[model samples]
Target chain A: METLFSEMQGALVVMPSGRLDTNTAPEAEKMLVDRIKGGMNQVVIDFTKTDYISSAGLRVILKAAKLLKGSSGKIALCNANAQIFEVLELSGFLTLLTHSDNLETALGIVGNPA
Target chain B: MTFRTILNAAFPPFSEARRTKPREMLFSVAEKPGIGTTFTVSLQHTLIVLTMVVYTVIIGKEIGLTDAALRGFVALEIVVMGLTTLLQSLPTRFGSGHLIVHTPSVISMAAFIAVANSFGIGAAAGGILLSGVVVIFFSGLLPRFRSLFPVEVIGILLVLLGLTLVEGGVQRFTGLHEGSFDTPTLLTASVTLGVIIAFSVWSPGRLRVFAVLAGVIAGMIVAYLSGLFGASQMAVVSSEPAFAFPLGNYQIPAPTLIIAAALPQLLIEVISAVDSIGTAVTIDKIDDARWTRPDMQMVGRTITAHGAGLVLNGLTGTPPLGTSSANLGLVAVTGVASRIVGTATGIMLVVLAFLPQVSAFITTIPRPVIGALIVYTAGYLMVVGMELILSRLLNSRRQFMVGLGITVGVSLMVMPELATGVPGHLKPILGSALIMGVVTAAVLNQIFRIGISQTARIELSGYSAAHDAAEFLEDRGAAWGARRDVISRAGITVGEVLEVLHNEHMVEGTVNLQATFDEYRLMLLLDYRGKAFKFAGDQTLDLAAFLEGDEDEDDLALDAAMSQMSGALIQNLADKVSSSSQKERAGLRMEFSH
Candidate 1:
């Protein structure tokens, strides 16, 4: 799996490709934590290219959400396929973090205040 | 726009939903087989159809037509069957564009004879004409009543249709002559049936497609050797003219309206139309592997073609025609369901009508061979019907719906005397096991549907709350006929929510679980006198800080993190979730799209 990182409207956009299961979740978590530590307070994870997610991936997102919240920052997710969205929903990630159907809305959500 | 254009717009040729071809089928509805394959498969279909024409001959003989006139009548019936079969295979406003063959209907034949015996032949034609109109009208209304025919009901119709053929199939297979079995006839039928089965099961590739034909050949040879096809039958075939015009010795009957004859004929035609629904479904299922539900639009078109054929039969002063299930069995055995074959078969039948000698030769095919074919078809229909019924998740209500339906249908077949006291007009509906069983099943389905609410509730208190909740959703899901996967997902989500509520100590006393299901979605509500969950908003637990805990606060931080994880899990499982509170009363609602 490859993870793409870019900047859109001052929010760090992180896109994970293929799967976001246990094998790739550690690398994805480290990248997000590094960006947060580097003062990128606003973040958006776009799942347009991602096809799957497991419980480990969910834990990584939860940890990122917690870290961002401690700094009074916001994180948003977008473009999740049905399977990925189902995982997010079932894991209760949707309740804790903002999500949108597309990247524009996700960026808009994260760029703005709570 | 022209009338045909208007009709096409009203009823499209194909269903809106596309279907995948079944893997078992060698040729599907839209597929075109090679010329040789098409002709060979068409020949098999044509032979099956020729066997069915015995009904036409019987109707003609019963009506006391002279030999010359009877020949013309049979020819006319064959021509109508060919035209209708051709129409049914074409993608026209009237055709279903499926490999549906038409033949003289046994159900309509008895009614036709009864009308002819009571009134004149012209009156019988008039009655047949009326039935044609009624059937066409019913076809338009059939798609609207698709809900009336669930999978199980169609299954019942198919099973009963098979059951109804049992006596005929068995009698011919056993070669029962009067009270005693004919040894030669039994031997011939066994050879034919055995060959067909062997070729179908053991043979590979193209050989399977000609199983029925090979069986016929083998049976005929056995029959000839056993003296079943002696010089008498040979003489009968030789006496027929090599070629002759169908109308040479017969005049079209002048149709005259007779209410007594037309009403009964109309009623019987309506029932026959219902029978065609089963045939259409069988053919539809045979061609498509991803078959979820009946394509009612195509079924309507099938009935339209059927009714139109009856109209032709009326004009031609011949017996009423129906979609042939025996030919459907032939399609199943051959694994070929190409409309091209249907078209070719139609043309062959029409051509054979002008070749009296060929039709006579086909008519001389040993009875045991035809019987073996019917028995093969009967077995296929019964098995396919059972598969259809078992496809759905059956609850007690649906179980009764299928069980009672089959019981009622089988009862009529076993003890036909049950309909002895019924009025003559109602006999068409009540006397026949297929009609009664389907009617009973359809009616009982509606009756059983009553009082079965879309919403159900259960109380969850002790240790089995999660298990009880899953079981509750499962039972209600089956009753609602919801998709099994959706039901399974719903059960899992509900169980997770109940576990969270109990483990988190969010609920104090008994929790009332209410589930509401519609075709589109399922909503689950958990109501209890307990603490409402704090949904994730801006709140976040610093897991790193908690793990590196200042000793005494570690347990509290761990508890908070665990609670947050559980909340996330529950929220993610459902498509939408919300919490409601009034004083000590709290409720959590979760919705899942079906």
Candidate 2:
């Protein structure tokens, strides 16, 4: 698995490719926590390339959401496949974060693009 | 342990152990009653079997046989009934090892009369011989066509059999003598029915086993007092010889095979075999508390015995024999289903054939009394048939199969003229409600099975994922003709697995659900790009501790608890559960026995 980070509308966009399971979750968590600590708070995780998620991967996203919430910054997720979306809905994670079917709507949820 | 100690441990003493009987049965199929109990029960069955000899009498009269010839024919029938009944109760290659009594078949009576009318008694005998061979041949093939006679189809056969008896039962009960209601006959029938119901329901211990006998004796007394049993009926009994050989005076005719006579008889024999199947199923179900499906092997043995009886009938120039449904009802009501009773009854029948006067006296049983017995048996059969039908998971296809099958059968019963326009030879198939109903149900069952695939697929995702997965399995299960209980379990297991997959964030793409079903088992496969579920050995969840835990720990505790619950539910619901993962893709398989 590979984690791709980019900037869109002043928001950090983190795209995870392949599976976001136990083997890759720790690395994804480390990268997100380091960026948030460096004062990049407004974020959107794009899951267009990611096809699987486990409880470990869910914990990584939950930790990032908690950190952003403490900083009073918004975080959103976009482009998650049906399985990932179902997982988020069933786990009660959707209550803490905003999500959209596409990246543009997700970026708008975090901050308006220029 | 030593060998002696180990052997003693494995096998308990008889005094320390008790064999469990089915709740409905007093004496099970394997249990043997004492001589006194056996004799009385056998006598009750013998009375019921004797009443069916009126069909033989009718056929004899129709065929214009001499009075002495008619007596010989009736004697031959009684002998065949006895031998076949005895054969059916024995646990041999030919017998079903159940209490299946044999009697002259009303279907064969009609076919024989037709053949006799067209050709002669010699040709009729030859036709019966051919039909017997065909019946035995068909018995071998019936087990292969097990899928055709599903529970619902057998239900239709049973219901039709009950319905067919209603015309005669109600007529005799109402005492429609000379197109007028006879008060005496009605009173006698009511008393007979009343005593039977009372003894069956309220009587205690050994008294209950003699319920039918009590009812018959009471009915006979009522008939004698009401002038229904006059000196004229007694005269007929007195005129019969005290003891005579079956073939002493009557001459045997050389049977000549005729295609015109044998073809219709062969067709009717096939339908009669269907009746034997229903009887076999009824007796099998009565014997076992946890009967899941028809024991086709035993059923084949039953038909084999029935065919053997027909073969004997052919050689002796008598009417073909069938498994008696009335005796089955008697067994159920009296709670005595011992095969020994069957043996005793058969012996009594053969003994009665020699004592012609005794058999004549039994035939003098009032029509109303016989009617009451038929009504009781009809009620029992119809209820049992309905239970069998409801035992299956019915979709629209199955509903139509059962509904239309019954409608066709009942239609012929209500409108006898429906077969009047058909050719004379086809009347046997189309005229009889039992034959038409079973044929329609079997054919419709095959027709409705056209588009139903054994395997089905659906994509399950989103908030209603679990619900959607359950519904998909149910619909497909019904279409594949799976048992209701098995299908329901499958649905519940799939729902539980889906909940786990969704709640644990286990899948990242749509979960593709695929189901495959054969008669014996159902298999479900779920594939998705996801993490394999981690089923922890420990399933116990500390609800109290989780409730009192810190908020951060509470969420983690709930997640662990839900995963444990999912694993436990999946394990209990399915016969087998297996999971496999390759790289990023995961698969879960659940199997349920049908």
Candidate 3:
């Protein structure tokens, strides 16, 4: 349930380590959403260390995505494990979201929104 | 007002509630015993546990097994018991890591004897081996079907087993005649029992733990003097080779005999699983420091090991093995609750298996002495069973289940004549009081238990985090027939709540969740011993408001946003949510409606 918050290329990089299920999604949501509320729009959610993500986690990201959309801001996911990727794909979250294979690509995607 | 009244008024509603800290024990689960101590303690354990070898002789003799076959059986039993004890006592992947000795189970012995008597040795071996496989297969499925054999049911079975053992002891002590007591047998038994009691009462530290062994020895001496141990027996002992391949020329029992013995063997093996689990729990309690409710994983492994041991026993043409409850008491009394001791004991047993002479000497111990040991051990088991039953709050339902089991079990055991009129095949199943009682208890428990079987309490340790909790909800919700969408939402909501708690560093406590389902809604009731949790309020983002914010204003807004964000997802997902806290504990109730 540890989240590392960093800023690179004007986008907040939110790396939540461990599970992103009900037990941890709240902290993750608050950390990411607060950054968005603080006027940082572009974001990269690094899931390299996260092994599992449930719908509760998806909801948090979806909620943040909705808020970011209102402000013309964007969010991208990078380094997701198969389980998280499957969860995202099953929910059609990938359709609404942008994803990258690694942090550098995520930074590129969020830095230059297309 | 008087001074006392004035003082009481000033300190109104004072209570004497005390918080209990965790208990520490003299020896912990991880502690290793000294090498010197391990050998001495193991020797003491080996001596007492050798009684099982004597039991094999009694059962083997009745089955008319050849001396070589008997020797092979005892030797193989010793090795298997030792190996299984190592598996069970060592804190390994399979062992319970407690000071429990594995020995040939009397229940299995009885089943084999009955089967061999009716069908032949081959049938008995087949039944025992098949049952072992069944038990091994069943161990994996136990968690799912655990409700069928709850504490109450197992407790009743244990009590019945104890009573039955005592009954068998009395029968042996009274000789062949069921109605009359034999003077010589009674005297020998009395002397054995007296010596055991005396040693238990007055034997010094360490020696007291070997009281049973000492008593058996004393009984043997008395029996020899009384002409029970004659020249013929001495000749047999002298003729036994000092060394031999334990099972070199061992005869395999016919597989057809196994088919005939299958039903009874299955029944015995089923109970053996129950018995092993109970023994593991009892030993865990005996080794109190590292104790938690019998770790289901350990219990499962131990039961599987029991079956595997029985399979080996069948192959060796010996009896099935079980965790010895008497050895647990010995461990407690000796204050040597170490896996090292158990491992050493297992090794010694394996060595003993090769020594035909040693096995022969053990057989020389008179029948009355073995009977005395059974009576003493059975007495302990009966009390343990009674204590287990009484430990819980028994309602009318439990009373009925226990009463039915005891009444039926005791009657069948006490009245063997009832089986005389019954068919031969049914005798093994119906004739035995213990088996009958087990079935009665299990059936009654299941019938009564159906009323309140829907809810389950899952206690989460400090290590369990959000995903664990969410998975629990998802699994239970699915099982409870909740729709996928509802299950999904509930899982997310709980996961988010736990995450918030974890982030606040409020995760240093146990979390318990109770889930209940009905037609309208799925409810999750969460209780934990930690700081109270509050759902985050809604903080909808406004671009215009953010654009106009001061530099410091953004920081303040973020804090407000953080507070609001906690319950945002849960609020949108669940129909209703409520939380309350009292003292240091907190409870949350959430209901997800379709």
Q: Candidates' DockQ values?
A: 0.08, 0.02, 0.04
Report RMSD (Å) for each prediction in the order shown.
13.3, 14.8, 22.0
Off by over 4 Å in 2: A1-114, B1-21, B177-180, B531-566, B581-583
State the lDDT of candidate 1 residue by residue for B444-541, as single tens digits. 98898889899999999886676577688878988976656566666656665666676668889899999998655789998999888668773344
For candidate 3, write residues B287-395 as lDDT tens digits: 5542223355556666767777877777767777777866765665555666678878988888877877776776666778777877776886787778666644455
* lDDT, candidates in the order shown: 0.83, 0.82, 0.70
lDDT of 2 at B223: 96
- How good is the docking of model 1, by CAPRI class? incorrect
Q: Chain A structural similarity (TM-score) per candidate? A: 0.95, 0.95, 0.94
Q: After superposing the true interface residues, what Cα RMSD does each candidate give?
A: 8.1, 9.4, 7.9
What ordering of candidates by TM-score runs from best to worst?
2, 1, 3
Task: Supply the DockQ value of model 3.
Answer: 0.04
Cα lDDT of model 1 by residue, A60-84, tens digit: 6766676677777888999987656
Which lDDT tens digits does candidate 2 get at residues B1-594?
897675334321112112346786888888999898889888989999999999998998898888898898888889999999998887766777778999989767778888888888888889888888888777766777899888889988889888989989989888886789889989999999999999999988678788888898889999999998979999999999899987745566667799988888888987898899999999878877767778777787788888888888888888788889999999888888898999888888998899999988988899999999999988889999998888788899999999999999999999999899977766878798889899999999999999888999999888667657767877887787678777766766676677677666889968999999987789999999999866667554443344334535545654565565457656766888889999999999989877
